[model samples]
Target: MTEVELTMSQRLRCLVIGIPQATFPEGLLRPDEAASIPYAQLAEHLPLPDTLELVVAPLFCDDFDALEIIETLGSAGYRRVLRIVAPKLPNRQIVLRELRSHAVRQGITLEMVEEG
Candidate 1:
């Protein structure tokens, strides 16, 4: 999203999945609007997000973990896009296509982005 669009979307809640809490990239998120969760703790209950909810996760994780994250987010009442950030991933076209289809079926939008 463009900077102006993001600024317009108030309280853009985000869940940084599996990334260490310490590496949450300070200043990238407004304190009240974001949090990082360990993959192991994903089973815990999460509040239904208000407005847009952006989920940041690694694309290189085990396939099951990726699917599980989607399921968990859906179960937690997340109804917006899950924006996964990865620097690089193999078989990008195939992976993105498959995941996009699955994400759509679960009533979630999937957006994959590469970042270093």
Candidate 2:
């Protein structure tokens, strides 16, 4: 008899911070076409990367303080913090914000990525 081998896939979750007010390739889609699609629909078209956990409490302002909420989420199930940088955001503010969170008491570090 021959032995059978099998492989298992791991499920990964990732948090998407800062829902962009606008999208790239502007003017490519007609206003009607753009307005027709929903976030869930968009997610299907553009799949998230592997090894992501969850994105919690998107802070619009760099000065917004939500450490408790963030820490709670991090402790619950989150393993990594992924920061999304977009042209619409203030570059200096983002950098400063990242620096502030770098000193998290719970030892959570936000990894900033230029692109999703």
The lDDT of each candidate is 0.67, 0.39
Of candidate 2, the 10-residue stretch with the lowest lDDT total is 1-10
Write out the backbone clash pairs for model 2: 13-52, 13-53, 14-53, 15-54, 15-55
How many residue pairs clash in each candidate at the backbone level? 0, 5
**Over all chains combined, what TM-score does candidate 2 have?**
0.34
lDDT of 1 by residue, 6-96 (tens): 3444665776666663355688767656666567655542454475567888765644356677787777777688876666777777888
- Give the clashing pairs for model 1: none
Best by the lDDT measure: 1
Return model 2's CA RMSD, one decimal: 12.3
Per-candidate TM vs. native?
A: 0.71, 0.34
